[model samples]
Target: MPDRDVRPVRVRLLEAAARLLADEGPRALTTRRLASEVGASTMVVYHHFGGMPELVRAVIVEGFARLAEHMAAVPRTADPVADLGRLALAYRANARANPHLYAVMFGGVPLDGQAPPAEEPVAGRAASGAGTFGVETFAAETFGVLVEAAARAMDAGRLRRDDPEHVSAQLWSAVHGFVMLELAGQFTGGAETVLTSMLVNLGVGLGDAPDAAARSLRAALDTPAP
Candidate 1:
């Protein structure tokens, strides 16, 4: 007899759902379709996730978890600004690797003919509340990584003494905009050069000495991210 696949049902379901979404887009992810893909019954999804919305929520949460792992893997050096830039590159890499899922994760792609929740609740507030499943919690946690990095830079006197949250939000906006444009194929020339320039400029604006920060950013870009 053949050996059995012993993975948890929830894991199997999430994997199938991710593949379905990646291969065919969100519209292809239905309970029946996921069940068929995983060689299970629709009841399995219900048993694990309660319903399609919750399952979709799980998928988004899983994407953020992977993203956080990728960012966290960046080695922290004396330069916090450079560290933040490394995290931004990790963010872009994650999106590039998971283009289809990236859309669903941030572009507000619908699932099962229903749109995702409009508002993102604060992380760790309440999971039982509507739209408060792992979705908002994981998303917030992922963003928190950037915020905390900014705080560290501020404490080290490498960045401007502004609100860390605000600083992170600005950096995030710049990185996300560039990434979105890159993913859209708007970059006719060297996107990495542009990204590095923007990051260097951001570092200068923050508080770092312009010459040293730019040199560090250029050097950091030389080291390829995993």
Candidate 2:
């Protein structure tokens, strides 16, 4: 006879939830549906996450955690701008690979305006039983990776002497805007070409020498992401 799967219930629920969220939108994440997907009873969802709101929050947290892992894997080089550019590429790739999860992570449409309903005091305590931190903490920590990279670039004289937070925010906005547009089918031309142009422009705008920064970014793009 085939062996019974023995993975922990929480892990199984999370994996099933992620797949369901990706395939169907947030609305499809009913407790019954999750339980059905994972071949478990509805009590399993409650036993693990307390309720749907907590489960959805967990899914978003897991998504950001994966994104952070992808960005963290990017190798840091002497060329901070290039490194930043490569990180941007990685971000785009991650979003593409997990469009539905990405949407959930970034509060995209359908799920965009819908904030998770607050848990009742009893439910909150039950949810907190898992000892999970707030989602914003994870998100801020992930964003700090970019801010630190920007600081490194400025310190190395590769970029202009600007507030690292401001620089990081600007770069993030530009890259994120492009990714959103591309995902929405707004780009008529090659998305990669447009991305390269945008990165080059960003480097030129912030770097001490326009030519050197552009060359460095172009070279960075040529190298495969680690």
Candidate 3:
């Protein structure tokens, strides 16, 4: 397949770019440095991605793509609420697995020395107009997994009848904030405890019966994180 020729080099370049951004910040992301980091010629980056801006965009999108894979791997159970809880764990696991990519995927990776606007919209609300690099496609798709899971829970009466998208956004916000804090070392050894409680509280807030929600979340957490 044609992708066979493209995927390896592209992935290497993307990974190298993410590491450079993580280790040295945005200003350190030069073509020569990236090429040297991967022991490839600078032309490889340009050939694979065309230019720096495009490569950065690819890295962010790839981050989302990897996240989607992680969530998608979560096996669906009979209990939708439990599935949602497991998905939250999967989301955190992905972030912990690649903190560098998470930083680059979300905010915190300043773009070429440009400061983010004071009041940028959230990525879920307005990907392009959010005064940030646009990775709308993968971002939307990744968030869509949660939307579908939320809809399933709502349909099963595990949650109240509200907009699934809205509920998904709230859950995403909670997980995203927790992941960011954890990456920044804000959480102590109690990350697992805090996240479990937060998931249970989120479930209760969505109108689930407290006992059922806590039970489901605890059961889900007992399994290996997807």
Candidate 4:
């Protein structure tokens, strides 16, 4: 071999931690266990993350970054409502894809009322007139994307004219609730269908353009005489 890559080792460690967090829960995370899981020595884990708290934060940040990437990947269509729907579906899919990482990114670990380890400062404007993370906290990065999309929808006249900030927050809250409950197995109905219906109704209230695109797609499918 042309020499093994060290970077992949660190990445594997982080990926292991994220999976452990989602599958077993935060309490189960430990450097020793992580090292064993990744087939690396305990010293390697320390070298990569310094300590447990820092490692926790890195994993959480990675989780959020992945979410932001997914949100960014949602296709941009001229129709803002359709775009938002795509974004919403993407959000749920990510959570389902990485449940533990999602939990850690959201303060899933019981830290005795302390905040989960934050790897970096939230990047945005703070309410105190100081600039902060605004909504750029790695954990909630997806929420930021949703807020921005909501505002774009309003600006494009696809959604109703409302407070973008308020509507964005509300929309995020609803979607998060659905994901959380579904993860907890609280929803007996399939989460996929439920979430789609939820977003459709939410679009109606939030100002999705008339169902023209959906109608057109359906019509195209219905036309059979090739």
Best by TM-score: 3
Candidate 2 collision pairs? none
lDDT tens digits, residues 1-226, model 3? 3343344666777788888898889889999999997778999887876777667777776788788889999888889999999899899999988888888888778776533233234454322222333466667878988999899999999999999999999999999999899999998799888988999999999999999999999888887886
Over 4 Å off in model 3, which ranges? 1-7, 113-134
**Which numbered prediction scores highest in lDDT against the true structure?**
3
**Candidates 2 and 3: which is better by lDDT?**
3
Worst 10 residues of 3 by lDDT: 125-134
Model 2 CA lDDT for position 74: 82
Position 48, candidate 3: lDDT: 74
Model 2 sits at a Cα RMSD from the real structure of: 4.3
Clashes of each: 0, 0, 0, 7
RMSD of each: 4.4, 4.3, 6.3, 6.9
lDDT of 3 at 221: 81
Q: Per-residue CA lDDT of candidate 4, range 1-226, in tens?
A: 6756456786677788877776776666787889899778999888876777667656666677667777888765565656666666677778888787787677665543223443444344331211223224643566667777778878987778888778988877888899899988998878666775677677776655448535422332233211
- Decide which is better by TM-score, 2 or 3: 3
